[model samples]
Target: MTSTPPLRQQCPPGACDCHRERLLENPDADLRILLLTRNEEQRLLERLENLKDLADLQRMQQKLQEQLGIRLHIAPGFNEVRTTRGIEFDFEDQPGLCRKTRQAIPAAIRRSMEKNPEIAWRLLDSHDLLGGL
Candidate 1:
């Protein structure tokens, strides 16, 4: 007497629901994060950083527009456009921090001063920025 093979072996490739059964057997098997490689994790972190930067730039643009009474847009790669009372102008956003303002800012911390008083302030304040100070 010959015994029957397993159900999967008995059926042709597309004739069985074995694939669905395997998935239903383990629900979390479909989660991509569980299979992420080191490179994938790094890429995800970089993408998050880029998203944060874009959000910061947009917030700065909004504040500048309110302060200057203009319609302002800050685009990527050093480009800015402002429209005031129907007059529009474009400008390149170059780093304009004075040499003194670019110095070690420990004194600023001691004084509890958060604003830069010359250019932009820190978007995110964290211990990492202090470099273990």
Candidate 2:
């Protein structure tokens, strides 16, 4: 019987190595941004619920895709914005908010929330309660 040689070890380039080292040393060195909008009070709450559900669903979807080599059509919707600073003045327009579909927002939110739950909770908690009509 012939024995095969072990595969050669591969190391990433210098820039990649530097980034990896930095990431390992300081994982939270970078800032993250999150953007959310609500047209109505009820809609905001609904959005938060939807975000949690969507996150769980997508997590399962990703696992299945990786294990079974199956491609799931999650559909394309909304433009998720990412920035170093959370502040962005252009979001005031309805079109910017409207362009984002319900599906995308949850996934985007789930990702952001996972990375930064405190920020997500703070945003969610900021809403005031509405009295019975």
Candidate 3:
């Protein structure tokens, strides 16, 4: 182990313009409280967004059911973007929602192609479909 060095002459608070003079930047109780508050706000916003999405999705599902006379259940928290072409659905339901999703794909494709005649089904996931890379 190396020997500890003894303290030299001490310099006062204003000795250097480092972080020692910063305001409200201390990692103390106040900082912890502030961080917690911010996190809580973000969580609340996320929950509100989730609720909005779920409600909108329910309305869309009702419309589809009325039109097609079939039940299509979408897993919660899925993000969807509706464009002039069609609805772009995104979710993490890797194994659960495939059957229901497949039912919607054909109609979605038809709507997309009808709106934009240039749409190619084989290249649905291509960069051009997403406004280029």
lDDT of 2 at 47: 44
List where candidate 2 sits over 4 angstroms from the true fold.
Answer: 1-101, 128-133
Query: For all candidates, what are the clash counts?
Result: 0, 0, 0
Between candidates 1 and 3, the one scoring higher on lDDT is 3
RMSD (CA, angstroms), candidate 3: 22.0
lDDT of 3 by residue, 1-133 (tens): 9984331222245543213223234444122212223344345334323333334435645653453233454321223334323434343222112233343344453444454444332233343344553
- Whole-model lDDT values for every prediction: 0.29, 0.35, 0.35
The global Cα lDDT (0 to 1) of model 1 is 0.29
Report the error of model 2 at residue 65, Å.
33
Q: Sorted on lDDT, highest at the top, how do the candidates line up?
A: 3, 2, 1
Better candidate number, 1 or 2, judged by TM-score:
2
Model 2 has a clash total of 0
